[model samples]
Target chain A: MAFVVGMLIKTAAVPIVVAVVVTWLLHRLERLKPHAATLGVACGFIAGWFFQEFSVWFPVRYLDWFPAAALILALLPRVSPITAAWLLVPAFPKMVPPRLWAVGLLTVSTYGLAWFLNKATDKIQQRVIVGVFMATGTACSLVLLQSFSLKFAQIAGLLTASLTAALLSANKPYGNAKGLPFLFIGLMCNLMFIGYANTSSDVPTWCFALPLVAPLVLLWNPGSKKLQAVRYALVVTILMVAVIPALLVHPPWEAEH
Target chain B: MSRNILIICAMALLLTGCNSEEATNPSPDAGDNTTPETSSGSGFAVTSENTKVLFVGTKKSGDSQAGGFKEVSGTIGVDGDKITSVNVVIQVDSLFSDQDKLTGHLKNEDFFSVKEFPELTFASSKVEGSGEVTITGELNMHGQTGEISFPATVSVTDGNVKLDAKFKVDRTKFGMNYTGQPDNPINAEVDIEILVNAE
Candidate 1:
């Protein structure tokens, strides 16, 4: 029992529980409201920040703050743009002048890209875009965690994967059409920060590109009888392809001969 | 749609900018100018063949595991029975644990980050005491330096010196802060036993 409990904590059981509860809440909330996806994303962002503050898995630092701030801006652009912009103030003190400017620009641009992707005419396209973002973020975070031997990477990956699964399920034809791109943007930013911060060795350049490239597979729209199944299969295949190389290349455990 | 694809491609290209091997792997430095050059025919020379540096770390269960380095080289300046100075460098890559997996893990980024911090060095700032000697020095490891003091018994005979010391060092002080799991936590204080033979 002691060993089991230890393993559970090590595998990030807290984040898993949080993800399950958030997914259930999103499913229920979507039934009652039109902008339920936005609310759900906001909830997730808050949960991530809360966990970072209280849990050992997430570092309570500027890197974690930027993602939550970006999410707020994306989700509630009209209501919280100024407040969210203010949230980025914490990042300035931690970085040098040049780095602060570069990261600041990147954060704003990425948030813009997520906002643009959210405006897709086709529902499937929007879901696919969000899926790709989450999948890539998960893969990158996993690789970073594995490479650096960080326990928190597991929590980050679990949270992102859970959110992706929830988003994909919630956006089915009969389900709520509203998807959570803002949440994914925040998660991706967090994972990207982890990847950048944890990398101590020469990881293959292709590992970084795989997540971005995997979604291209979705462009092949097969008009089959089982169209939904094919799309799901394609998404899964893309994610697997993106993640496998990262696990294989310069694996953290491989000892130097 | 075409614009979206282009934007995503641009985003991917921008993310490529986030690739940072330099940030994680700090530039190696022989920190604080503590590594002193050994002059021939002056200071007593210490080599791998004549030195043994063993470290004992405890698990959360209070069980201790011992590990040692196969290679260490140093120089100790002596004036008669009084030790003047000492400079020792232990190869991080040369660590030998009872468990091979543990050895590999120790060399990884979680502990020594051997690729970045390949060597651990101790350069004595002051050496005092008559019979049982106390050496105060700056220990550099894992890109961090801290002052440390240890007591050792020194025995010199026929131009050969053998020094033995057992000391406790907090691994967290050197940035080695992985403390295992809650039920299986590793003790922060590592017991180190040093045996140096200089000729």
Candidate 2:
């Protein structure tokens, strides 16, 4: 009962603090009205959720690619730069996950070229800008993985080969930390299965603190324009990389009651 | 105003003291143990051979579970009732799981960031035996250092020495927080179990 209260406190405390800080920043810089700021916060929250859940799929992750695809519409001088700017966020993590990177690069490049085209026409929509950038970045990443080959089969083959190599190397005891999360999940599934058959123990009180600190830091000081944008990207990147291993390496017995 | 600053400072100091390492077990029911001064009967000499240490921790809730930490390597020096010095190294990536893909990701940036900060280590400053062994040490993990204590039991029988301790570790100290699957995320309180044999 105490643990549950603590966890709720921890979870609520951080996000509330973050919302305050972010709200302050938007008001200070963008001079957005209170209502507009509220709307933006809601949008940001939704966007965060999208980044968390949907980005796993290539198409959703690469939504930023749509702006680039709108290059035809983005030919308008005002819109192209804004769409281009969003690219900086996703590109921060050099090694994004396999699915996200592949889809993102493909979609971003395709849309980016389109945006470049629209840049000549000047009919880009604000909504489409984020999407085009996502697509273009995803598309370009695919190209880079395939060493810029235009051939689709070659690109798919390269992706498969890369995945196979990563998996093969992961089977060994050591090499890179990237392989730990998968192992952790397997252990947890076994535990959960056992937990279903038997009993599971209560998690300790302090488990609630992990998510609280980092988000508070990011929200409070989104920092300079470059850093503010990069900060979110950085937080997301680190979490993306670390969560799986933390789970894989987790012991099965602890879950036992 | 300056008053707010002063209040903040005072609050910080209070927190520091609250989190500071205690000399012995936090429970009053536990025996009161202090560093012994004079030598008693024949001091139990740790067999200068065949001593090893084991550490275990678990994620508990969220995306992870519980298990023994496999890559623990450390040294124990005992002199009479006092443990003069103890140093230990835990490979954060050693937690085992069935799937290979997840383990690889555990070592990635979202988790241990093993490349950036690989080892979780502790060096004891003082050890005293009352009923249970109380060892206070400086623990270093994820680039942060803090003083912590582990309640332990020590015994010497035949030619072997055994040391056991159980405690908790917080992963937030190392800056690992990812929310994709919060239900099974890394548990902040990593239960640590240690067993050591001294030579």
Candidate 3:
């Protein structure tokens, strides 16, 4: 009974969290309905899973060509809306992670961020710079996990900092490998953050504020006191209960095992 | 670089040769009385349109395990309605499962020890029973050879031969001990269900 209750709670929480994120993003886009936003998020998840399952019995597990295919098909202006909706399910499976989902997510996210930043600054050089930072960060994190904190810091600092400094001094080479380190670092950071989030029993209210407040401050700078109060109260309420790093605990038995 | 390439090529050739028949009749001793009659209709021939082999069994540690050889090429022959030969060529690297971690581990040293012993072949010394057959054979796995007896149902349906067999073998008998307790055996009783179709 307790196990059932726990499972039900988890199932409910995933959609709720996804919905919350979607709602927040859509709030900035005028005339976008909440239902449409929810649907989009759901579709993306389904598409991820579909592509992920395709790896099974499909010899090449690493080459996930579905995401790019979906993006291209989506861009076809003459494509029917219903066709797009049907394509969304297979696309949804692609978003779900297989065993190495965390690694892939970090790598892709790093590369994506670098590309975005490159576009924004009109400087291809930033790609290498970002890549160096990410790789160094991952290596440092891994080393830290291996040893005492002080030793980790000393070794990581000496090795990673020097490597990054050298790469930067080279004025950012236009190599494909530049983005790799950043992806590694990003993955480590995400894993560590999840670990910390789950382990800390008493999460300060400021924790919730970081994800929500940082973007709002950067983009909107709202002056309404009422909205500010609500945000603070919400954060406080969230902080009151421990934010157990949800990713830390996996089921004792593997579903397929 | 050339050395590495040469080594890899040699290994690939070695794996290829392993799939080929080693001997029509190979005995440990030069002077042996056992003569396996090949021409006397003494082999169980399995036929299938799709020649894929699948295995579902519990690991020695009682973990529900399933994997299959993507490239399993074999011929099972019967002598007088009994199985006398089982030549199975299971690609060690081709063993697959939905579970990625388990699949990788199975290919590692703890389980299949695929690098060391890439193929499993069971050649029977004796065959008994009628419709329900009991085959006493030498089951070679992980380079450690052991004698095993198991029951099988052999039949011909619609011009195609089907072989279904189930047997339990102690992995320990072949030096595959990974985990378990002395007081309460954690080492699993490995159950094998093999269905083969001759091409």
Against the true two-chain complex, what DockQ does each candidate achieve? 0.10, 0.01, 0.04
Q: Which should have the higher TM-score, number 1 or number 2?
A: 1
A59-147 per-residue lDDT for model 2 (tens digits) = 32222232232231212222222223232222211222232333233233323333233332122222222222222222222222111
* Total residue pair clashes for candidate 3: 37
Tell me the lDDT of model 3 at A112. Answer: 39
* Local accuracy of candidate 2 as per-residue lDDT tens digits, B1-199: 3563355345444543564222111111111222233233333222213333333334435344444445655555555554555666666556443443344335444455443345667767887774377899888775567788878887655444577777776666644444333454445566666766654
TM-score of each: 0.62, 0.38, 0.35
Interface RMSD of each: 9.9, 20.8, 21.2
| Model 3 ranges with Cα > 4 A deviation | A1-257, B1-37, B42-53, B57-63, B79-84, B157-159, B180-186
Runs with alpha carbons beyond 4 Å of true place in candidate 1: A1-122, A125-148, A158-212, A221-228, A238-257, B1-34, B37-41, B45-50, B69-74, B90-100, B115-119, B157-159
Sort the predicted structures by DockQ, highest score first: 1, 3, 2
Query: For candidate 1, lDDT tens digit of each residue in B48-103?
Result: 89889999999878787789988787787776776677888887778888865566
Scoring the B chain of model 2 against the true B chain gives a TM-score of 0.61
* Candidate 1 clashing pairs, residues 3+ apart or interchain: none
Residue B132 shift from truth in candidate 3, angstroms: 0.6
Q: Tell me the spans in candidate 2 whose CA falls farther than 4 Å from its real position.
A: A1-129, A136-257, B1-64, B156-160, B177-187
Between candidates 1 and 3, the DockQ winner: 1
Q: What 10-residue stretch in candidate 2 chain A is worst by lDDT?
A: A192-201
Query: How much does candidate 3 score in TM-score?
Result: 0.35
